[model samples]
Target: MENRPKVGIGVIIIKGNKILLGKRKNTHGEGSWCYPGGHLEFGESWEECSRREVWEEVGIQIKNLRFGTITNDIFENEHKHYITISMISDYESGEVKLMEPDKFDKWEWFEWDKLPSPLFLPTINQLKEGFNPF
Candidate 1:
């Protein structure tokens, strides 16, 4: 068993009245809806990780980046722990494209109150804490 928790970054890309999320296809949170994000790379700041992950996963650039919230998620079934920093950003440029088909099915915009079920742990926590990026 790992003794340390992993660090991750989640990006909340707000457009109009909707937020961007993706249906996870593979890995730990498979079959859940989540925001565009990934593991925080070594030597990378949380903001940098947010930008890179968002661009890598969904092929979009984000601006007006700001700290949203943080969640300590423990996936008991998957035996993984993560300290996720949620970052808020507005959609700036680039079209919404699935840059990682193997990792996610597709990306879509959804209203906060009507988000899809089985949300990722981090996202679930964020919502439960009333972390609204709008």
Candidate 2:
């Protein structure tokens, strides 16, 4: 899907002292850690996409959604480019689960200063963009 830059939503769900992340599987960023998120659907708002992706991927809900930052991530190897809409949100409810096991290996929470290795490209770009949840 390289016709043009597609829009994606990457939500950083914040807890008391940690945030939710998932290990990518069977996709572009396979084996890399990333925030709970997915592509922006047609006729949907960014806020809606943030909550939807989190629930769809991790079986959890998020609130207080606010703009975090944006990244123009170009996956050269996959020949795909995306304008990632980063959303910062507070953990709302529900237990985290591998709702889409095929897309993610497992879900985990990590301190802002202590994250897992091999972050997804869009995630790495978010950090490079100076966007912080803490």
Candidate 3:
């Protein structure tokens, strides 16, 4: 079998000292709290995909999108993986709504230092590496 990298994107929507997080509603990592993002669809630019995903999943428009981090995840059991490119963005417009109700149960803003535990592993790691709690 040939190996191919799965490309995905994540948006870190920061407002003051808190960050936006979504409780996943879909099967893969369902019930896990994560950043707003999803797979990069074919032929879509990273910026476009990032903005689209943030809007679709969280119902908000994003501005000042900038490169953040890239995570390469390799699962041992399922042979599933992802190469996630993350970005930092400011909230531009729109009210919070569950656009994909089945994919996410809820949305909340949390202080970085006080984020709930057991967050999606990659997101947790990214937080540690890229964000300063204080």
lDDT of 1 at 133: 78
List, residue by residue over 80-131, the lDDT tens digit for candidate 2.
Answer: 8999988999998899898998888999999988989999998899788777
Each prediction's number of clashing residue pairs:
0, 0, 1
**Candidate 3: tens digits of C-alpha lDDT, residues 1-134:** 86887887888888778888888765566667888898999999989998899888877887888888887766545577888887888878888788888888888999877887568756866776785423
The TM-score measured for candidate 2 stands at: 0.95
| lDDT value, residue 11 of candidate 1 | 92
Over 41-103, each residue of candidate 1 has an lDDT whose tens digit, in order, gives: 889998899999998998888899999999999999998899999999999999999899999
TM-score for every candidate vs. truth? 0.96, 0.95, 0.87
Task: Say which prediction, candidate 2 or candidate 3, comes out ahead on lDDT.
Answer: 2
- Reference-based lDDT, residue 73, model 1: 98
Tell me which residue pairs clash in candidate 1: none
